[model samples]
Target chain A: MTQQISTMTATETVIQAENVNIYYGSNLAVRNVFLDIPPRQITAFIGPSGCGKSTILRCFNRLNDLIEGFRLQGRITYHNHNLYAKDIDPVSVRRHIGMVFQKPNPFPKTIYDNVAYGPRVNNYEGNLDELVESSLRRAALWDEVKDKLGENGFSLSGGQQQRLSIARTIAVDPEVLLMDEPCSALDPIATLKIEELMKDLKEKYTIIIVTHNMQQAARVSDMTAFFNAEATAEQGGKVGYLVEFDETTKIFTQPSQEATQDYVSGRFG
Target chain B: MIPAAQPQKSVDLGDLKIDHSSRRSLFTIAMTILASACMLLTLIPLIAVLTYVFLQGFRRFNLPLLTQLPPPPGLTEGGIANAILGTLIVVGIAAIISVPFGVLAAVFLAEFGKGNPLARWVRFATNVLSGVPSIVAGVFAYGLLVKTGLTGYSAIAGGVALSVLMLPTIIRTTDEALQIVPKEVRMASVGLGASNYQTILKIVLPAAVPSIITGVTLAIARAAGETAPLIFTALNSSFWPGGVLEPISSLSVLVYNFATVPYEPQKQLAWAGALILVLMVLMTSIAARLATRQKTY
Candidate 1:
């Protein structure tokens, strides 16, 4: 573990999960998993449907707590603090670890208000105009929308709405950003734009994105974690497990594991 | 390259073409005729009611009839001003009592309820209350308010009964409206670090405003036309009500009284009052529609 930590000295680890397992009622959705997400770098989780990539991403911000009967057995530490500690507030965790969903979910409000909502709710007592402007700029949407901040968010095109959702997330100045298939609903051009924005955003915030698109994982991520499902003896059903985690270049080029090679090379999911 | 496969002769059969086009036209024509017949059926009753009301009530449509109070048994020199005023006051008070509680209840059911047993029971009770007869609500209010001498035979008692009648409507409407607010919006607010109360107030309530207003307006309109409850609670006072605790006569009660009278003039006044009541309801409904015209998204 010391050697592994020292090998990535330039980028520090921000989130560390040890033998994390998640269950919804009696059914286990995610098997024991271990992962370390580095600071100021993008980490992409790639897998087929129901491979627990999104579930793991949701666990980081405790979004899965919204589900009934959801329980977890694990130690997930953020900045050396246990995220699921009894005294820690999920609301505050979510505020610092913002999320962008697969679908573009801008609030039913004006573009300006949508961007300003986070700051206002969290009581960020700074210059709001500056905050909204900077956040929108970081999201790569300020130029196109600068003149029409008062217009309704739904008036924007799909790409713009997704960007607006990103802007809304960043407006709170979160330390870590989690995107659950943020560009799945976007066209190729929009996807490219968001990809570029993600590259830029990683300089300031750690990003963990769950994407089914393997090419996107290879192109944008510094490290890639490939996940797959394996049959469980007790449940007689497939449960998601992390198959491999390595540098993105190595994962795509010369993966150590046969499953990672097959997944990246498109032989199988 | 292989020669292109010859077209299948059977696939382009003329009989199939004719059958398809003929069936398509038949279906189209059938749908058109059905829609037209439905529209005509809906319009006929509306036109007939309007024509009948206008013809019967036009003779008594004068400024004096609107401004003056209803005449006594032998006299023929008055309007329904007091009754109209009383109706407005009673409905306004009922609306004041019902809207906040109903909206709050709906918010709880939609946002925090999550199928909890208490929320489910509250919802079930609201549904049952909605099905309860308005007169029964009047009886309930009379038992609670009049029997206890809280505000015996007063506008306050009438408003309380009407508010009960309106509560179910407002709750159901607000519930449906809040339910219609996309779940993503609430999640987004919660994601933004806003508390549950703040999310309901800033996000859920605003998104549901139009539907809530429509429901509240419909409740008010329905409450304005209620006479049985008003009769039991507000009783019929010839003089104008001085306060919420004083008994008042509403338009419906005045119409009921005048229509049952032996005089010809009173009967005409009843028709006039009916026309006015219909007009007021129509105006309110139209205003509500206009107010909610803004696009929700």
Candidate 2:
């Protein structure tokens, strides 16, 4: 399928992927992806499992660099800076674009330390106590965790831990927040709370999420990109491609592609 | 003709029958007895050794024994204080020598060089080194350090010998400890913009500290009781240990020397020294247990 451009103005786009091909060694994992994520809005990547949504999401912050054989072709740009260029350090790139993983993985340290870790590593020259407090407040976790900030992060409940992870990610003051299925491991009530938090966060940070839940994409995202995988003869066995990209309401109500329609209406994936 | 098979809709709890004397029960009882017998068999040697040592050593295991120096062959009122201090100094030096090198090598194996050719050869070398006898380590250290006149029959040479024996255990245990840390925890660190080195130093190493401490303690325990290495390296000193450059008297070496003498008093003191060495090793093992029991992550 051809690339589908959304109605959003290009001037507002904070991240752009142009003709990107992701590979693990010689095997192509995702082929020819083009996406433009606008600032201060939620962009959700919706797909079935093994469709490379998470893989592409990791590319934004160059988190894929940790995998031994991962490689990316073409370009991913954050505000016209070529992220894969020779001089660009992945560590610094990560400082500007942070990530929240599917499973909430807070450090084994105290809650305060967990939130302060990123800033400390980045050498943030500010009042650390205030930063931790604001980050926790912005994550909607301050009230629940404030009294026990000295406790180990592992002591918290699953939902609160996930919130703590969010607080930790934001504490570094990243311009973009990449969440890979942030609420998948959470209960419905916790998921709803996170959805509300995402709605609140979109006002400040450029939020890009990869989700398996269609309703979550519908409820929380401003733009939605639908991806689908096809069987391939390559060693990787399957290759994912973007099937459709548009406003969330349009994609949910009347998608241009049959696959998107089938996926959204519960006919197929 | 086959009767119509009727599927029971629900279980009747009141009518359920359980056989109390089935073959399974008999097998379970037989296995339980065998396991208990095996456990008791294992405990016998430990209890017997402790009981015998306590009985023989209690005669000389008095305050004077810990405070006074080793007396002449016929005298009976002397202490093994010099031996105790020598053992502590030698073992402490061995720990200092082995711990840093072992941990760094383990870090290389577990993190930076995993699955690489160099790491494979390192692991192979560590395994072979661990299998090498403690006597061989003593000889190697004697040839390298003591015979070279770098440190002649001194505590430093003994430390080098014991450290050679200690290194492989520390490296292997620390590697295993680092390997068992959750992958997600590492990913979380990396995702938070930490460089690989920073992640290892700040997050990974701290999380593995408890297990690493356990390994070091066990290594120290093994080194403290080593008599063969000290025989070749730190040869016995009649007086108190002068310095690291001079010969020293450890509890194990004292035990080996006095146990074979013709005098009965020296022989009694030897039993007391053996008991002290055993107690030290036992305490170290208990410390290792407590270290591992702590919640590290």
In model 1, pairs of residues that clash are: B68-B79, B69-B79
Off by over 4 Å in 2: A234-236, B1-25
lDDT of 1 by residue, B1-297 (tens): 223444653343334334535877899889999999999999999999988888888888989777888788777868777888888998998999999999999989987899599999999999999999999989998999987998898998999999999999999989998998877677777777777788888888888898889899989888888988888898877876789888898889888988998998889888888888888899889877975786374
- Each prediction's TM-score against the native? 0.91, 0.95
Displacement of the residue A212 alpha carbon in candidate 1, Å: 1.8
Q: Give Cα-based local distance difference scores for all models.
A: 0.87, 0.91
Tell me the lDDT of model 2 at B277.
91
lDDT of 2 at B194: 91
Candidate achieving the largest DockQ: 2
What TM-score did chain B of candidate 2 earn? 0.92
| Full-model lDDT, candidate 1 | 0.87
